[model samples]
Target: MVFLPSLPAHMQRRAPSRRLGVWLWALALCLCLFGEGAPAWAADGEGDITLSSRYWIDASGVQSVDEVAAQPAGTLVEMDGFRSFSLGSSALWMRLDLPRLDPSQRWFLLLSAAAFTNEVDLYQRGADGGWIRQRAGDHLPVAQWDHPDQTPVFAIDAKVQGPVWLRVMNSPTPTSPRLQLLTENSLQTKRYWTFLMVGGYLGFGLLVLFLGWVHARLYGDRAFVAYCFYVAFMLGFQAAFTGIGGLFFWDQSARWNDMAPAVFMLWLTASGIWFVREVCAVSRHHRGVDRFVIAWSVFGLLYPLLYVNLQTPAAFAVLNLYGLLSVLLSVALCLWTWRLGEAYSGWLVLGFLPVHLGYPFPALRSAGVLPDSWAMQYAVLIGSAIEIPLLLYILHRRAKDFNENRARLRALESTDPLTGLTIPLVLTLRLRDALRRSRRYGHRCGMVLVELANHAEIVDREGREAGDRALVVAASRLSAVVRDVDTVCRVSDTRFAMLIEGPQRPEQLKLLAQHVVARGLERVPTLPVELTLRFRLVSATLPESGDSSEAANDDERLMERLHRALDRLASEPRRVVLHLPVRMPAGA
Candidate 1:
């Protein structure tokens, strides 16, 4: 093989295109780097001395304050936080030269970093030219720290004529240190904004949980239940990973402070998998992806046990990579579900993409792949906070879809396709409910079960299709004759039932039945054979057929009485259109 850059003969014309693509890519990269929202550099009198260009690093990290101070100023190489390195086990000392300013000028040295650093020592020259030392970091509990609520911030006395010496002994990662000199106003503004973001993150989580719980109760949707668990577990994981759990929640319990991050992440992954399973109904569309999600959840649930015991740097990086892997898997699963055209897939794809992309920034920062910055440290939380509103909208859509689907399923189960009427089981339930309502509210309810006369004769002479047409016509007339409060249903090929809600007398019921039979007989559909079709209407009114407690509660007895009335009418086939009067049983 030749070791020269060459393109194949088929791609010779594409060389210019390839170079153009590279230039476009370079331009896009420049825009991404320079178009971001990083704070501007503050000059000495602008806000405070930024120390961005004023600081020099000692890579060996072994020199004493006096020994380093003894060297020529030219010996030190200037670097900003963006140009720092991995000082493994060795403490890096950063020296900053301060200029004497007016008495009104007050400067605070602020190190904006995660609170995981073990040791931070700040040495300043006192009035007598001796070193005055100040300590801060997680090595001491919050109560004992110089500034508890913040990352290491120290007050620098401007009386010193020499440089300010700072030493950081921390993890063996390539952390780009963030150091800033802030005026009192700038310092307070930073604290105010930080506190506001933390509070907003917490409040957003609680609001999502509360709304999810209420919707879950209202609709009883499994997706909503998954959403509640996902939000709760996600908040727990964020509280831990963002250092809020250690500093605020578990300050008294050292083991809890150490293990909360991994434990909550495990549970968050579990709940996240379950949430995806519910929203997408993954088993219905993609069983293979569903199985993988299940396996991933199980692994995540068990991984935290190992994390509690292995607290080293390697273990920490592995755990963070695990989280990144989980997010990647989730994104793939959602994309697969969307490809399968699952319902509500848009909600999942749109609501989860931001957080999934943002998850890696914090993870890569933890794994030492990226430098320490506000985006790496806090973007995950911020992105997830934005996801709350998107997810809530998705949740609302999911719940509404669930309820509509449930109602449609119920209708399919209990409705007759031919006549579009309630079927046997559902009609019976409606009758029982009507009986209870009639008793409870002291209202009257009536039912009429009509069986067609000459229906069998027409089928026997012509065909079953002819009888079906007659039944359809009779059903239409029966429906037209009943009031809107009445329900009409096809019980059998020749029988149609109507439940009427009216407090009319017995004669009125008979009159209504007569009108139904007459109209039904008038509109019999023509068959191939030249013949006439007839129908009979027999109705039963509550408290008129049987007054016993058994008839009131027993659905079978009520149906039996209507069938008996129909049987009585069947004997008189000579009658063209029969309408039976209300008759009480023997017990009543």
Candidate 2:
């Protein structure tokens, strides 16, 4: 077979069209790269480009950064994102020997740092041939020998006129020995765009926080609380990353930047996973699959340290692939859940696409494979914005499901199977909760114990079915007369409990109980229904100290005291006794 650059015959003839297509793509890429908010920088012979620094291979041909201390001080150089191979030694450093530009010319200096040895320091070459500190506040603090991979950064700043030389120190044992410099472009026109982009992100983030807080209050949902916490972590981390934390908060602690990103990503991921799981009710269906989805999140959670230690382009690519895989898996799980008719799963599926597409764009751009621009950064932000609404939708659906399930479960547990009256178990638990709340908040709560007179005799004389009907009727009448906050429960075969909230006084509790009993009897009908019953009202005052835990304890004690008071009130021969409020431990 003969080797050919282009395909033979028809393919060769199509080469022109292929070239045209490639030119169109190139044109599109150019528009994307230079369309707006970008500083037009031509690559003049003097090399200045994007620059960031990490420990460089140093003196002893090892990766140890300590060796940089022993080498002749050199300058670190970098190029734009278009340049590749940021980790190895720069091929050459092109020195700019221009006479100092007029400092008042609104000039900006763009020094491209391909890579720094362990640390880079700026010094001025004195006329006496000694290197003196430039004192320009340009030196970044040294990082741990273990540094993350960041592309060579071009730190932009106002031009400084001096005989300046950047001192690049390598680890004592660098495997490569070299520095690179790339063409610097004037950025005077691009400053406004940069300010706007940064300002927009900050303002948008703040607005999201404010709106989320307001939405939380309006909805009164606990999930929003979690959402707020998650957003707080993310916004705080982003602010810290952009150097605003240093500028506005503290300048010396660069360590926060180093550590916070990893921590924030983990916390945010966990919170997001938990919120999704709750919304989807993953625990209710296919617990194993839910657990697997949860387990998969650990990959992102664990990858941060790897990212920190290996800030190489290859590491970035690996991470991008890993993130994409996780997103795909999540999408699959969400779709499966949706197919099974789960309500919140649709939101998860909708949210996944943007997050899946958006997260990897940064890695691609950082790797020089995708054009870096304001639009690209905003695309990620826009995708994140889309995700927020999906989460809110999920929360709303979850709240609806929660309310429905709560009503169903309450009915199942509390209502008597045959009579539809409140069962003892359900009413007791509800009463306990209200009492606990009342004690904690200094709210008034009262209880009435009711006994159906001669229930066993009625059941014996009437068939079991008739007895059950009577109980059902009594329950319906009791429910109609009492307020929604009040609970009526059949504590035993013949005994019932009614809990109410109102002013904390013995007379008021007795009156309320008497009214309920009187109204209930009137509803029973006068002809054939004898329906005699007795009730005792017990009232108590919650402590003003308002300690919920202490209040819980006090509620338990009050309940015990009420039982005692009931025992004494029952001593009366003919009628039911309405016990008066008995003051106990005021502190309790």
Residue range 1-588, candidate 1, lDDT tens digits: 101133345434533444434543553453365333333444354333333334445657676778866778786657643544555667667776766644576777777554446567788888887888888665555455565554777887765667787777665344556676766676777777666777788887998899999998998888888889889988887776666665677655545654665688778877887788888778997678778878877777887887667656776666676677776666666666755665455447557755765677666665566766667766667667767667778779777877898888888787776666778777787778877876666656778888877788888987988777777777677888878877788877778888877564566677787887677546344864356546676776664433545445466776777777788877776753444444445455
| Per-residue lDDT over 388-478 for candidate 2, one digit per residue giving the tens place of the 0 to 100 score | 6555655665666677787778787757766566776666677667666666566666676665554565577766665666566666666
Task: Give the C-alpha lDDT of model 2.
Answer: 0.50
Give the whole-model CA lDDT for all candidates, comma-separated: 0.68, 0.50
Worst 10 residues of 1 by lDDT: 1-10
